[model samples]
Target: MKVVIQRVKEGKVKVNGETVGKIEKGIVVLVGFEKGDIPSFLEKMADKIVNLRIFEDSEGKMNLSLKDIKGELLLVPNFTLAADCKKGRRPSFQSSENPEIAKNMFDKFVEICRKQIPVETGIFGAEMEVYILNDGPVTFILDSRELFQGGLS
Candidate 1:
């Protein structure tokens, strides 16, 4: 599993002219599930994302976590995060999780995030049009494998 976390002032997702999910001030998280995702993997990613201290603090230093700033999250499933584009013009998705597995892990991840802050989400596996107003342009990538191995500090 992998996640790209973007701190945003506002974000929204639309599909076919219908609004699916939106957030006011929070992180826009793009999640990617690789093969071998499991319950433990989902839990680890959830834990890691919520605790990331990418938000700024007093004196304008990046020292506040999502939990500290009381932020929201717009989570989207992005299988392309796993794309391998090292050697070819076309990227390879050999590391992406299958639909069944990915959907399961994605659902679990949403459930966990929703339990914390005001969480918005895009339709899992859907082609979504996302509009984001990035703030501070602060972004971080979380790897489920690394989190699972206790490297999240």
Candidate 2:
């Protein structure tokens, strides 16, 4: 599983001209799943996301975690994040997980994330338009596969 975490003052997702999920002052999580991904990856990613110290402290230092700020989360399923472009001008999605497995893992990840903070989610497999008001423009990429393999560097 891979995720792009963006700190935002507000975020919302719309599909087919209808609003689906929205959040206020939180992180926008774009999640991607691969074939070999497992629950262990989901668990670790959730922990890392909630505990990541990206928020500023009293002294204006990046020392406060999402939990510390009691922030919410906007989770969006994005298999496109796994797109492979190494070979040609057009990106390939061969690394992406099948919809069934991806949906299962996406739900599992959302469930785990909900335990830590309030979570809002876009419809899985739906075309969505996301709106974000970024804070500090902070963004991060996390690969649960790396964490599971003890390959985090």
The model with the greatest TM-score is 2
In the range 16-85, model 1's lDDT, one tens digit per residue, is 8899999888899998877776677766677777887788889788888888999888999889998889
Mind sharing the TM-score for model 2?
Answer: 0.95
Pairs of residues clashing in candidate 2: none
Cα lDDT of candidate 1 equals 0.84
- Per-prediction RMSD in angstroms? 1.4, 1.4
Q: What does candidate 2's lDDT look like per residue over 1-153, in tens digits?
A: 899999999999999999899999879999998877877888788888988999998999999988999999999999998899899799999989999989999998899999889999999999899999999899999888666696432
Candidate 1 steric clashes = 0
Q: Cα lDDT of all candidates, in order?
A: 0.84, 0.90
In order of appearance, the predictions have TM-scores of 0.93, 0.95
Clash totals for all candidate models: 0, 0
Find the 10 residues in a row with the least total lDDT in model 2. Answer: 144-153
